[model samples]
Target: MSLITFHRIYPSAIPPMRGDKSALGSLPAAAFQYCEAIRTASSFGWYVFPPLDIELKFDGAEVFCFAEESGWNKLSSLYFEDEFWREWDRFAPDDMKGYRIPYLTTLFVPGIVQIWSGLLVSTASDYSVLVRPLANVVSHRGYQVYEGIVETDRFAPCPLFINIRLIDTSRAIEVYQRDPLFQVQAIHRSCYADGGAYAEKIGLGPPDGVTHGMSATEWDGLRSTIRSAQPLRDSQIGRYGAAVRKRAKGQENID
Candidate 1:
C-alpha cells in the first residue's frame, strides 16, 4: 500500500490572540464543523499543522492569522524555483509583492488515493505545476461569512468556511481544456527517495527544508504584481460572481 501524507495550509493572517490557551479557542465551532464536513464528504485524511509564528496584517482585518512553520517553508521553497516563480509571478497576487499573504488559504485534495509516503516537495520546480492538478479538480462552495461573532464568550472574528471537494480529474480536464485561465499538462508516474507519488504516478525528489522563508526582495516583487493586477482580479471576480454563488449554494447537494 502507498503511504500518503496530508498537509493542511491555513491563512497566515489570523493567528490566535495573545494568551489564548487553546489553539481553537478563538475559532468558531461552526468553522471546525465545516472543516470536518469537508473531510468527511471528501473521504480524505487531514489534520491542522502545529501553529507557527508567521503573522500577517491586512489593511482592514482585525485579527492576524498565524501560519505554521512548515506551511511557510513549503510556500517559500516553491517560490524559489525559476519555473515556479515565473508562473507564480504571472498569476499569484503576492508574486511581485514584498512577502504579502495570500488573500485565500488553499487546501489540497490528493488526486491519487493509494499514494505511498510522499514528501512535501519544497524545491522542485515542477511541483508548482503539479499543484495544477489539485487546483483543477478541487471545488469550493457554501461560504457563509459571520462577522464579529463571539463563541464561548471569546471574540471570534469574521470566519468563512466554504465546502470544498475534489472532482474527478479526467472530467475536470475535459472541461478545463476550454478555459482560458487554466491548462492541463500531461501526467507522469514515477518514484523518488523522498516518497513523492501522485495519482498520475509522478515521482519527485526529496524535500529541501533549507530555504523556507521568503526574502525581502521576493516579497517586494509579489506586492508589485498584486498592485498591477488589482483591476483584472476585480473584473474576473465580478464576472464570475454568479457562478461562484451557484457553486456555494450547491455545495451541500454535491454528495
Candidate 2:
C-alpha cells in the first residue's frame, strides 16, 4: 500500500479527508444510484482545508485579509504565524528566503494568491502528488483554485499551499477551517514509468483487431459496454451503481 504523510504544528490546521460529505449530500438520488463515475470521482482523494478561518478582500489589483488573530490590517496577503513551526524555517534553502510564508501574494500570476495548507507533505519514493480543487464540491465561490502536479517524492518538503485566482473582486471571500479548499491524490511512479516512445498508431491490427473498422469480437465488446448494462434495471432505473458495487465485492464481473 502507498503512504502519504503530513506534518504540522498547529491545532487549527484541518486534516485531510477522503471526500466532501457535503458535496455528496448535494448529489441527487439519480447520481448516487447510477452515476458510478461521478460518485467515484468525488471520493477518490483526500480533501485539504484551510488552516484557519480567514476572510480575503480583493480590489482587482491587490488582496487584503481579516482574521481575529491577525488583527485588521493586511496587504497583498495575510500571515498566520506559528512560532513553533517557524523554527523549521531556518532549514529551508537559501533560495526560499522570502517565499515561505503562511500566506502570500504570488506575483507570478495576476489575481492569484497562495494560502498555506499549514502542512508539510511527503509521499513514498515511488509516488508523487496531485494538488487540485475538490472535484464534486457544490460551491459558486468567486475564485478558482489551481491544479498542480508536484513531485513530492523528491520535493524540498516545503509546506504545501494552494493557489487561488479571484474571479470577482467586489465581494469578500471567507474560508473556514472546516471547508476544503483542495484535494491531494498520490500518483504512483509507474504512471510515468513509460518514459520512452511506447505509443504507436497500429490500432488496426493484422486480423484479430480493428483492421478496416473493427473486428467482430471488438464490435461485441463495444456494444456490451453500454448495451449489456441497460437490461439490469431496478424498477425503472438502471442498476449501474449496484452492479459496480457487486463487482467491487468480488461478486462477479458485470459482463
Candidate 3:
C-alpha cells in the first residue's frame, strides 16, 4: 500500500520571554502548577502529553526557544548540539539572522514512537497520545503565537493522518487548504462487513496495517511539497540532516 507522509515546518523561532530570567524563576512554580493541572484534567478522562524539555537559545543578545521536543527525551545530545540550532536557523526568518548563544531546555513527555507505521494506526494511537502532553508543555513553556510559512510535498508523512478519520474530511481539507505546509492525498475505499478497504486514489495500494510503506516518487513528492511551502532560509537544514546522517553512519546515537 502507498502511504502519504505529511511534513510541516513552523517558520517562527521560539519566543523571547520563554528564555528570560523571570520565566526560568517561575518555571519550577509553573511546572508544579501545570502538573497539577494535567493530573486534575487527566482525572477527568483527558489525555495530557507532558513537557519533555524546555530549550532556551541565546543568539548572543536575543533569547528564544526554537523547538520543544515532547513524548521523548527532550534533552538528547542531538537536540542540544549546535547542529540542531544551525538547522533550526535555516528555517528562521530573514530578520532573525546573526544570532548566537541561545539557551535550550528539554521538556519531558511520555510515549514517543520512533518507528514508522501506517497513517491510520499511527495517527490514531501514537499521534493521539501527544495532544495532552503537548498541551502540558505549552502550558508551562508558553504558546508559540506566531504563524510562519509552511510548505508540503505530496509524499511527506502525515503526523496527523490517523486523526483525520476522527473528524470531517471536508473540514480537514478546508483547514489544510488554507495552511501553506499541509497536504493531503485523496484515498479511495471499498466498504465491507468487517471493515472498509482503503487505497490511495493514485493507484497506491491499501495502507499497510503494521508498516509505513511508500514509493520513492511519493516520498520525493512530499519532500518537494515541504520545500516549496517553506524553503529553508539558510543551509542549516542540510547541515543538520548531514550531521544526523553522519552520526548514524558512525554508529553513534541517532534519533
Q: List per-candidate RMSD values in Å.
A: 26.6, 4.5, 24.2
Candidate 3: TM-score?
A: 0.17
Output the worst ten-in-a-row residue range by lDDT, candidate 1.
112-121
Which residue pairs in candidate 2 have backbone atoms (N, alpha carbon, C) closer than 3 angstroms, thus clashing? Answer: none
Most accurate candidate by TM-score: 2
Order of the predicted models by TM-score, top scorer first: 2, 3, 1
Candidate 3 per-residue lDDT over residues 1-255, each given as its tens digit = 322222232223211111122222334554433343333332222111111233333222223333434422322222235664577588768775444322222223211112111122112111122211212223212122121111222222332211111111121111111111111222222222136555543435545665456678787866543324345543233333444445757957543
User: Alpha carbon lDDT of residue 52, candidate 3?
Assistant: 25
Poorly placed runs, candidate 2 (over 4 Å): 20-22, 69-74, 86-100, 156-158, 189-212, 227-239, 253-255
Q: 90-201, model 2: which lDDT tens digit per residue?
A: 6657775455465555555667878887787888887878888888775547788888878887884647788888778888887777778888888887776667336533
What lDDT would each prediction earn against the true structure? 0.26, 0.71, 0.29
TM-score (all chains, Cα) for each model = 0.16, 0.78, 0.17
Clashes of each: 29, 0, 43
